[model samples]
Target: MAPLEYLRPSDEGAAIALAEADGRACLLAGGTDVVGLLKDGVLAPSRLVDINALPIAGVEIRDGGLSIGALTRLSDVADHPAVRGRFPALAHAVLAAASPQLRNMATVGGSLLQRTRCGYFRDPVTPCNKRAPGTGCSAIDGEHRLHAILGGSDRCIAVHPSDPAVALLALDAVVRTRGSRKERAIPVDDLYLLPGSTPERETLLEHGELIVAVELPATSFAARSCYLKVRERASFEFALVSAAVALDVRGGVIRTARVALGGVAPRPWRARAAEAVLRGSRMTEATIAAAASAAVRDARPREQNAFKVELVRRVLTRVLATAGAGG
Candidate 1:
């Protein structure tokens, strides 16, 4: 392991300044993914700035919606009464991440900023585009059953490993970020960048930028939302296919709908075509099947992961039916 200097900043500005000063400095919150990266030798930061002392931790209801601070633990977010009552899909996604101990230690911002769980990328010896740009992606011709089927380019195909992000995309959540330049609000769905030419650039955040909080709108579909994750094992396993659906059906007709997919894309893939199919349509089996089909119409899966197309369709259909039927 590389010897690293640890700095604890008293305020958010100082933390941002330290990050801006040191080009190789990394922010540490909860140390869930950062610790793993350091241990695996995937990242060798010159310094680690601990943001635990920052006052960016809270779960409050404001502006007729929910505002969750960045440093809030996953366990706390999942167990919050308001989150469970209003955003069941988001809560379920949070609860379904990692293990109990990990969820207890992982922060909301850290979870969103977590790197890919690709075997090739995790191993420092492997040539991964995400880890070292221009080295080429090993998963292209290697073991890529867990790789992305959507939003992938020739350079990279690693799937994003965030369950909460998929749920947030369905819920239309907004991300609030702060930096040395200024503060800005970004849609949760727009925060991620597709691996086109630069595979190393994961998000749109700048050098000294930090996620401050996530704001969720108070939508009527919140009460009728669901998150379905399918994996090889029940617990302590990443999703092979996951679907998050939020439906606002009124008198047998759908007024609004949101659908997002995970474990099959470089980012949280929103099914806007599926939403278009559901809007103003009756909640029926045929309608649900059509919506599911629309969700994966443009999916481009690799040779080994072709089954993900069907798996994503099935998960979307089931989740849409369950959420629409109030089950």
Candidate 2:
């Protein structure tokens, strides 16, 4: 570990300015991910700007939609009545994350901004393009059983590790942020960046930009949604393949559908092709099978992670069925 200064800002602007002034300063919200990185020597910031005192830690109903403060705990969001009743997928995704203790300390913003669990990236001694650009990606030809199959390039192939992010992508959530320049709203789909050549830049967030809240628009499909995660164990483990599905079914046909996959891509992947196959289609085994096949049509699985191609298809089929049944 490295010696660092800690400062708590009285306001959002002050926090952003403090971070912007020092290029190596890092914002600390829940300290779940940032602390771990610091201890592991993955990050050595000159200063830690504590933003826990900021007035941004609650769930609110905003004009028929939902707004979750960035500092809000994952456990609180999971247990919120509005989240459970309206955005079931979001609630389930939070519950399906880390254990109860971690959920209590992990904030919504921290979860979205959490780094990948790729062993190469976490170990400073290893060669990982994400951790140090220009260095080779060890996972490419090494142990990549948990690497990405979709949206991967020769530069890197590490899967993202956030269950709630997948649900947020499916719900079309927008992340609200306040930066050194101005406040802006970014779509959840646009928040992540692929590891094309700059694997070091994981997200689209600008330097010194702080996530304030997440806005989820009220949609008919949001209520009838489901999240399914397949992991090696029942607790304290990351997903091998996961799917979040939202369907608005009228009469017997699907009206609107939202499909997102995790643990098989560098980011929370939106299966637009699968959604296109489901719209106006009857909720049946045949329809789900076709949609599932379409979801993995473009998958470029590696040697060790090739099983993920079939695993994601099965998971998507089950999640879509679950969401459709709820409707």
Q: Candidate 1 at 305: error in angstroms?
A: 0.6
Clashing pairs for predicted structure model 2, backbone only: none
Lowest lDDT 10-residue stretch of candidate 1: 318-327
Candidate 2 lDDT over 186-292, as tens digits, reads 99999999999998999989878999999999988899998999999987889999999999999999999999999999999999999999999999999999999
User: How close is every model to the real structure, measured as TM-score?
Assistant: 0.98, 0.99
lDDT of predicted model 1: 0.91
Model 1 stretches with alpha carbons more than 4 Å out = none
After the best TM-score superposition of candidate 1, give how far the Cα of residue 103 lies from its true spot, in angstroms: 0.7
Error of 1 at 51 (Å): 0.6
Cα lDDT of candidate 2 equals 0.93
